[model samples]
Target: MTTDAQAGPITLADVRAALADTDPSRTNAGALRKVLGRGSYATIQKHLDAIRAERAPAPPEAPGAVPAPPAEALHAIWGAAWAQAQVMTLARMERLSAERDTALALAAAQAQDVAGLAAEIDAQAAAAQDLADSQAQALAAAQGVALEATARADRQAQELAAARAEIERITAAAAQAAALAEREATIERQTLQAALERQIDKYTDLKAVVDHLKPMAG
Candidate 1:
């Protein structure tokens, strides 16, 4: 708690006055209490009530806090206050029907404005949630697409691997066939040469027979 001595040129009355300065707009009570400084909501409200009852002009509101009443709101409040005064004054003589109606209308309008602000806040929150939901959906879709692409790539890789294996098998079979053909060609050349040598020996044997027969004839 700040004492008057600790706070230079300030007093408890200053704090009360600061609390009095706050416009009683529909704001968070907790927030207002914090702004009032070193007090509870009841304390701040007591100060406000005292200021109003004592007919003192509240101090200017804190700079850059929650927006205080605008000119229009102040005017409206003044007009309503004036109407209320007139009704109170005239109540002894006659009913202030017009003033009552105007006050009721202004009150209704203010209530509608509060309601509208609440609705707008809710709408903005809903829009934010919708945007987040859409982004989440988009992320999920992207992940799904990525997963599908990965599966497709895996399938394609498998097929390519199978194709490469088939190619290797075919190339190996062709090499084996080429080697067999070369061996067969060599065997056929050796067999033909052996047959030619045998035929030459037969021809020599036939020539001996011919020589023997000629001698016998002579």
Candidate 2:
């Protein structure tokens, strides 16, 4: 247990002074008990408590001079003021301690709130990153489709060029075949005319021979 010197108002030196002095406030209760040889320790403790209460914290010096009390009540008023001062001091200390604890608790709660906010920000950032990644993937797919479309268009252009070339080649062949047919028709007509002239010459020669033989018989 804590000693009275550590917890109470009076120090060891004060105890020694009280023991040496003849005054009531300075005198030791233990020695007084021996002198009286009658009261219990509990009685002594009660008297000590009274003295302590009388010596309690003081009030503010009454703000200024106000009204003076009657001489009969002066002593009572002074004692009452001293007792009030002691009570006020203890109350103010207790109040200040309570306020300090409240401030500390509030500070701790605010720190936790800050941590929660930071975690929320981190979660949001992760979600945003996921969204950004999805967007990037979609853009890449669109670009790939555009490239494929460009390649298909190029292939179609090449096919169209080849089709035009084939059409031109077929047209040239048709023209050449038409020209050859016209030349063959002209050659057939000339051969038929030469055969007709040879037949006509043979017929004229046979008629002349028959006429000469008849005139000689007559």
- Residue 62 displacement (Å), model 1: 55
Q: List the residue pairs that clash in candidate 2.
A: 18-26, 56-86, 57-85, 57-86, 58-85
| Strongest candidate by lDDT | 1
Which regions of candidate 1 deviate over 4 angstroms?
1-111, 208-218
The 10 consecutive residues of candidate 2 with the worst lDDT sum are: 10-19
Model 1 agreement with the true structure over 1-218: per-residue lDDT tens digits: 77665345433474454546555443344665566545566655655555556665668987776767799989999999999998888884455687788889999999999999999999999999999999999999999999999999999999999999999999999999999999999999999999998999999899989988998899
Q: Give the TM-score of candidate 2.
A: 0.50
Candidate 1: the clashing residue pairs are: none
lDDT of 1: 0.77
lDDT of prediction 2: 0.74
